[model samples]
Target: MFFKIFIFLLFFIQSSYAHELRPAIANLNIYEEDNITNATLSIRLNLEAIIAEVDINHSNTKESKQSDKYESLRNMSAVELLEKFNSKIKNLQNKIYLISTNSNYNLVLLNIDIPGVGNTNVARDTIVDFDIQNIKDEDLKFFWDKNLGSIILRVNSPNNEDLYSKLIATGKKSDWFNPKNKKEVDFFDNIRSYTHLGFKHIIPKGLDHILFVLALFLLTPKIKPLLLQVSIFTLAHTITLFLGVLNLIKIPSVIVEPIIALSICFIAIENLFTENIKKTRPYIIFIFGLLHGLGFAGILNEIGISDGLFISSLISFNVGVELGQISVIFLSYVFIALLFQKRLWYRNKVTRPLSLIIASIGLYWFIQRLFF
Candidate 1:
């Protein structure tokens, strides 16, 4: 019964993890002028093609209600009400973007001069909006009057509504071919009203990401294999991250996420039975990491940062993520590696169980993500 339960758990995990992981892309662009930083912002999901889904239920309900004799025409139409609400929601969530630092904020009311859309320069006016809630500093006057060239936009949340409000401009990050100049671009970087500390989304807090990496490294416990897999994953993620951000390649979250979860479960299961990683492990990891990285990028994409200073920001953010991942690996090794040294049966009992557990958790995530 114990063995049977373990097997059942294994299948459950595989199924769940397979559907939970979504793929996204993060990209940053920095624009500079006259040595002083003019705009340094990061843009995420600038090129996401949100395929509109027709609401059949809504249509059917509206038709049925119209045919009802008892219902008054004056009565609030559910379909009409839904349509109005959805429209407002869609407008707010068109291209969600977040401004990172809202402290001592300079809410510039920018009338962007898109080359084709408007008259002249993109950063023409310098009228800043005022929000007293975020102003904690005594010297708030500096942000109000000074023409400080530096503008940093960062994403705090990655929800649909947030994306529509914060993300200023929309286009492929890599669309250098049709250089519409800065004026024709979308989101303009002007600081907003919010908290002082740097803000980011909560997606990184997911346990599946950790388990995926853990499962990948548990088998060999050797530096070489670990390094190879890590390197491949990093490289693959980088490629897709860039591509996804630029809108060069767009993969829907619904499809990409579940697959990533499945990948985690599969790796853990393989570790349970297979002793050798085989030479192709690195290659496979790279491919999957590419998908996973895109998902990570999605958070950043929702937040808009200036085109200037994007390089430094991107490098720093990527490094920060890497450091976080490495810290997890170190802690796990310290906690589990020493145990393996003491007992040979540790491989069969502890390692396998741990792998199974990881796989099970991943499976659960997959199911919840897909069905829910």
Candidate 2:
């Protein structure tokens, strides 16, 4: 019966997150100096998606002979357009921040610090990087979001003028390049930016992390054990995140990503079969957390961090991640405990199908990560 249910869920989840070719490109580049840093970022927003969303929202206006697509877009609300652009930016930022935090860097935002901007209608490049002196091994992994077609980090030598030139050249190659007033960006003022990035990293975009926590909750559903498990998972992942980012312990994404996917599957399957939450679950989660941490580190390796403040960056990033995880747990209990815990109909009809479905999706991710 369980197997049948699991198989059905496999079908359901595959249909839900079917991989679509993304419409945007994002990349991160890092270069270190004794105490100064430079990071060049490129994000090409999916103009199609943006336009589609706008068209859908404001379709009541009558068709006119003067309707030029570009002009129409320009006429759209600045608030609405900025909101959409910011939403996409925030998601990319969250993912990048998570990767950076895992990689052991506290990425502070110096300013808007973009290279160029002329008109508001056209998509503009948003470039930001920091200068630091204390480089740590934990701050070297590269992170990219395959789903979103966004690149997070590309690190280069601190004083390598050639590398810097290459980054600029590549930006030019993209037809949408808009070079504007060059402005100096201060790295220290980015504390607030770092905090915002960290908060979003854990809360909204950390779906995989949230799912991991949920799997734990469904299995234990008790206070003491749940707290212990959360702590262990957090500690274990943080330790390995530092190690992996620092390059002391290196694991290929070919190995790490698939296993991370498998961890999700394992937790979900266990929820169905295991009655007693083992005292050793924390230890096991710690081991798997280590793997996930490596995966997280890979993300930061892609985004450049200033070498001067590497340790503090690491601490701050990890702290943000911990806070994000805790928020997930609190919210899950608040919503799920109230909605489903008291209802047997959900426990059986809904929970069974839902878990099986989610697990199947996890299984699919496992295979894709391993084989493809």
Candidate 3:
């Protein structure tokens, strides 16, 4: 039963290219065409997931009942996917809400750019454009439906650059913003929102990260060694995550992912040999942590950070990640370590087998990421 369950998990994890359902990012630009105000909206989203009506709340399409439908849509060519979208244009229209001067505007389809079915395992980026007309000189409010999930929204005006930007929650209306005026955003709100996102990124969505943390746990349940390694890991990742977001250190995911897998494999292999924390283990873990931070930066880059809220959001996200790591450690202690750490056969019966399994999975992931 355990083997079967593990195999099933591996299959789903492999299929989940993005691993998480990232919030769609919408950029709206307003301009005057012959004295008439017109706005163009370009939103980046996973069209296949939307078309299949997959429940994004569960992290990825593989977790949905409509997973098969999503796969079929995901593999469609650009033109083929456009046709599928047209079939449900009305439903799609209702998903995005735009209000100006208390008047609602219907978005007219402009164009869609869908990439070819390249690497069907990875989620494809589709840019859909729409034109919004009949804008008044009042606050514009945007709302994304619960069915459509969350969205990161940005508005730009001819007179002002980056007029407004916010991460709108599903089914919740945004704070009103006018293009002509400068406004101050709530500081605490940005912190609270991103902290939640950062936590979510690790707990349920970040499978690779979870496994890496578990590999650390399997080393030993001793508080001093465990705490020391985790602290070093956290410090190193924090440094790189900040530098990565600033574009100071820019390495593509292709290089970073394989190294991350190797790190997992290395730590698990070490566990099989060492009964306690090795003298050089902390330094090695620190290096791996730096690599993992680059991975975290990729997610932040996708979500985007407004110039005004950069520091607060970044710090909050790191805090959330730390909290997630702590949660994983706490649970492992309660369930496995507390019960088994003191057993005479603990090292031979528990840690050895688990470490081997982790090492195997890590090696498999490394090979898959490198060649496939």
Candidate 4:
């Protein structure tokens, strides 16, 4: 009824545990000494996440076969973790890609900061510093392999003033910035970039979000009802996505994720029971959308949008999300629902069975996200 990859990811979640994959945040600062320019890159990351080699595409760490090794590293003392990191030093640097217009600069580890094994309950935030020289004064470009996951790169001036920041998408090389000249990205380009980000999130990346949208469609096969629900869900999430990113209404992912799973469970279960659209369904969905928006915010927050691009970025991202949800509905209707919705047994045979599977998946996610 749903995507095969969705089914695959469901099994992934089933075997996985509590750790979620988070982006590594890196800040690059430029320093000038006697007319020469050098830069220091400080990255705050979950070293264990990289050391244990979690699958980059999946959202949860437990999805990886090496998750056991990841957990073991997570439980290690600061010194122990450093030893693990040292073992992978050469291979790890090969994973990082940084270049200028003229040449590739090597990343030399200056030092590192690792926390003492404090809360084995949470992923430890390890910060590492590296030095890269700039002799030719060429603009710098950054690239991240999927294996390294996503990166939130911020550029700073020697005076400590913010120069530029971006959530560099995977495998995509960033615009050449710094080295006394930052690349100018026009408004339309920003829209395209953010929109792609939003679409990517819903289509392949956001399994939980995809389930919610599909559940909405299974409830009412008609275009009108589905559109109404989708529109309301879109608007509600847009409001909270902006608010969540701006830090006006911040809700931790820990609380938001479980509730999001619960919302999907509610919708899928409702599909199994209700024949006609409920008047109150939209209202309930509106509230759920708000919570989902907060979950959406976690991505942008990690990415760190610039003040100037905040409005454009948020609107573009929401538009992309809408496009993504619409794509799901459109494909389902064209392929599956269209041929079957008119049948007398459609609701009983198609809708109920699919809804049951979806409901079960949601329930599992809820319990896993909550207490696991």
What are the TM-scores, per candidate, against the unseen true structure? 0.51, 0.56, 0.93, 0.80
Question: lDDT per residue, candidate 1, 274-369, as tens digits?
Answer: 877777777778878887877866645644434544554455446555665676678767887765735778778767877887777667667755
lDDT of 2 by residue, 1-372 (tens): 767866755654343223121223344444555544445544544332333332322211112222255345444454544554454544545544323334434444433333322343233333434333344433333343433333322233434321211111111221111112112223453344344445555565455566677787776456887888888888888888788768899877888877887888787787776656777677779988888788667755554344544565566667777778888778878877667766756556545555665676678788876665
Clashes of each: 43, 32, 0, 0
Ranking the candidates on TM-score from highest down gives 3, 4, 2, 1
Q: Candidate 1 — worst ten consecutive residues by lDDT sum?
A: 140-149
- Give the higher-lDDT candidate: 1 or 2: 2
Model 3 gets an lDDT of: 0.85
Residue 224 alpha-carbon offset, candidate 2, angstroms: 1.5
Off by over 4 Å in 4: 1-9, 13-24, 31-38, 44-81, 94-106, 111-126, 132-138, 144-150, 158-161, 167-172, 179-183
Please report the TM-score between candidate 1 and the true structure. 0.51
In model 3, where do residues sit more than 4 Å from their true spots? 1-5, 16-19, 32-36
lDDT of 2 at 229: 81
**RMSD to native, candidate 2:** 13.9
Better of 3 and 4 by TM-score: 3
RMSD of 3: 2.0
The lDDT ranking, best first, is 3, 4, 2, 1
Clashes of 4: 0
Which is the leading candidate under TM-score? 3
Model 2 ranges off by over 4 Å: 1-158, 161-188, 343-351
